[model samples]
Target: MDLEPPLSYGHGICRPRGFAKDPLVKTVPAIEALHPEMTEWRRDFHRHPELSFEETRTAGLVAQRLRDFGLDPVEGIGKTGVAAVIDSGKPGPSLALRADMDALPMDDRGGKDWHSHTAGVAHTCGHDGHTAALLGVARHLAAHPPASGRVVLIFQPAEENGLGARAMIDDGLLDRFPFDEVYAFHNMPLLAPGQAGVRTGPTLNGYIVWEIAVEGVGGHGAAFFKATDPLQAAARLAAEISSIVGRYLDPAESGLITVCSLQAGHSHNVIPAHATLSGTMRALKPEVMELLYQRLETACRGVAELTGCTIACKRLAEVPPCVNAPEGADRAAAACAEVLGEGAVIRDHPPFPFTDDFALFLEAAPGAYLFLGQESAMCHNPAYDFDDALLPVAASIFTTLVRQRLGYAGTHARSVAPPST
Candidate 1:
């Protein structure tokens, strides 16, 4: 199946609620009430960025905030991650809402006043915004407990390295706070601020990293035929590997292979005995991903044989494509439209080449991953910053999803069953 569909193209149908309406106006008063504290929370996080799997300070703050919101908080999942449960006073099925809490390893070039104080660590991916938005939901939901069911607010770590979600699952996150449905969101820099792009199925691509090493014989520059240069062999491999995207893979299939790094010897006059090359591989389908990997290995081996060199290949990180459940995505879209307005939520756009760890969660539960526009530069760029204006919209959307799934309006409140210990 062609997994690279146009953005916002959900196979399931949604009831029309008019064109592009603002869904937050009704909840504005409530959000406004919480705006000051939310902004402070985001700024504090922005000033202190933490890299993947090293979110101690960030995780601590999240746990403390959840406790203050009256939710029982659990920490140390996935090493430096946290999860909290808000049990409503009524009865219904449980729901989960997740937000990633790890920052990228990069220098902040945005020059914002609240830029990262930790050298070489920054929230270039807008994780600070995601964390604060979820915190906003926790605070709001705490003040006004949902009418029924329970809410599991997850503050995940190591999203940049694609390990947080996997860690939580392995640690029995679902078992601790079992739920019928789960949901998560990411901030997209390309889209306009305050606007959201939500798709029902196959939203993000799959990614794999490969490292190749070529070994040859070193010799002095004066030697005419004594040295077998691994650098030349590696160069040939890079050029040939680039063709995997264009020739080996189907033209219709979306795939990319880029050789990002190549390292060799130090002396200018001598041929290096070994050369190392590393790059990323991306595809929208599993078969295509496998095809790319196989083609790359074949190309590298062929180049090594022709050049009289030894080749070694290692597969690094592999993340599966994020496929949203059709029914779950439909429900999320309706909830988004109802909370952010039909106009504020755009249903169609291009699929992101980037990968998300949330795909792991979808494997165990029905859920949807939506994008909230940051209105800044692209993610991973040093110029990126989260637009605080979108926090209320996100929080309101989260709140609405909880209320809708539990079948409660704003007025009535209830308590839910305690999760089995």
Candidate 2:
């Protein structure tokens, strides 16, 4: 097999040539040619990461890029979300592609030259890369207009706290950009590069973050029965919290509950009057999550009764399970296979333990969530970085979905013309 010389651009992106010879790989050559631009956009986003609902700069840049691609973008849909459309001017079903745009409220230690400049915000979850890839798709679609149907591009905010999708929906996103189906992707380090994971039904879990407060009287440390100890009550509740899933849920069903943070005393000699515990519970089903909540309340009540303290439990945030529509999942798998070869698309993988707000989009319309393989530390890790190589790979998969599902007539595949020197 002869390999063509690597394509080099001004920004130093060298893509391996000769993809046409491989029968299974159908990645768009034009998208691959846009690698340098995408890399620049991605790194720019990385350097200026923003927290949820505060993506003014990121949204502005994304809107400007969409405009540069010759598409009209509507900004501020979900406070800081942006949406644009590319219509083929023919009658067919509408498709929506979404990308998240918020960064975690954490410090970046990735050590890259383009690492986050924001003091307390970073794109540790690869939202920066997701936005850039989708922007590439926007440019490609604008250049090579689809022959029929509408392709909606959505850049959403606040996904880190699982509120972006709902925010958009509440802001009439579905009504304004009405799509028959939606699609999104997240980068995963668990799989090898050049691979994609697509699973039908229950691709990611639903979760709820909860907090419990235990109140008791403050007393001297040496006193035996002078006062009730809230710290001891909080500790007992924390220990019992882990047992709720195993005791209430079925042996085969998946459930989780963990006490992540506990606060009570500030000194060593005095017993504090108040103790608080916070954690999360997750399940693949809504009813199971509710069950876990009920069990948690029961545990708190029991501990309060046993330790003579007043206990209160509260649910902070809730995101439902992300179950993929069968048809959408099949189409996504085929599209990924087109870009990464048949063997690179995995369909037998188990549901991921993480949660995504995209689940809400699936509830509103039929769609699928996919995982793009990458070589890096897992997302949310301080040292994590997004792989630039997957930029074209993901864009091609999204583009293939448009070409395959929304047919393009009379347009032969053409290589992208390099920018004028």
Candidate 3:
């Protein structure tokens, strides 16, 4: 169950040759053949990026691809999301694999030939790569069904906004698909290409966005006694809120409260009537997140009262932390080792501050979220691109995991269990 093997940089332990020689590698030929198509799909997606809950074309593309793969595709389950079901002939446990399908509101600076053609919107977070990888898996699974279970392929939207996962759950995604285990992968630029990283639990921090508005009397700046400056209230609120993390949060719990933006008066000589502060609170535990929210609210109200200002705090988006199931993590580690060799896998790494909606699915089912090294620029950067060379390796890993879980070998393995009631 311990897959945290020592790793060396540029060791080339799991070369493409080893993958090509493996039997599972042969099953990837179809995926490889569709690589060009996949790339085109990715580029097309990149060129026409869509923001959260507005992925009309993206959803249509995913649905069409699923239909072409001979699976039953369901659309609009989570507001522009798509889910495809691939049933095996026999009966067994059901599994779900998910990928995000949203773009960020940023312009592409990657300068790639297939850069985003859309203005002020791009796949800077590599959701396009995620979508492509899941599509690759869907193709492979369609051709080579599992022996004893069903696979639900989910193309989720609004991950960038941190709402898609919850939206899907709210729409009864689990009730409809009913998966025993769900798995997801994200491309990481921090690691080298073809390398895989997995943590047993709590791979990402919980994040909540909050908006604070302070209102006070506006007056001439020269008359200090005449006005209650909202800007001063905003400043005090920011400083005091930051102190809560340092003083209130447990030292053992990793937490951060960053006031990312502050907006106040337009005139330099006039005290503003209102000021606004917006930022995020990140912590590794739900209790920590809750505590931080309470403390933030108390500080905002206290600062407002102390400054003779009125304040309002609103929660924008709250995403739960991702905790990989122990069993699923062990299985994922084993599959990675089997596909990429033991030495190529890094099992232990510090959890990240980034939040993912995949945590929602994991909360519903026993599952593991994995990070695959892509050797590209870090996510959220316009220069980032998914390492296409890792396609076969990733495909191999997914196939191996499915085979190991279902006790099947070779392509075309059918089902063995009944659908979940």
Top-lDDT structure, candidate number: 2
- Give a tens-digit lDDT track for model 1, residues 342-364: 66676665677779888888877
lDDT of each: 0.79, 0.86, 0.79
Per-candidate TM-scores read 0.87, 0.89, 0.89
Q: Give candidate 3's TM-score.
A: 0.89
- Candidate 2, 347: how far from true, in Å? 0.3
Off by over 4 Å in 3: 1-30, 409-421
Candidate 2 residue-wise lDDT at 338: 71
Considering TM-score, where higher is better, how would the candidates rank from best to worst? 2, 3, 1
Residue-wise lDDT of candidate 3 within 211-328, one digit each (tens)?
Answer: 9989899999999589988999999998898799889987888888989999998987898899999999987788899999999999987887798899999999998899999998
344 in model 3: Cα distance from truth in Å? 1.4
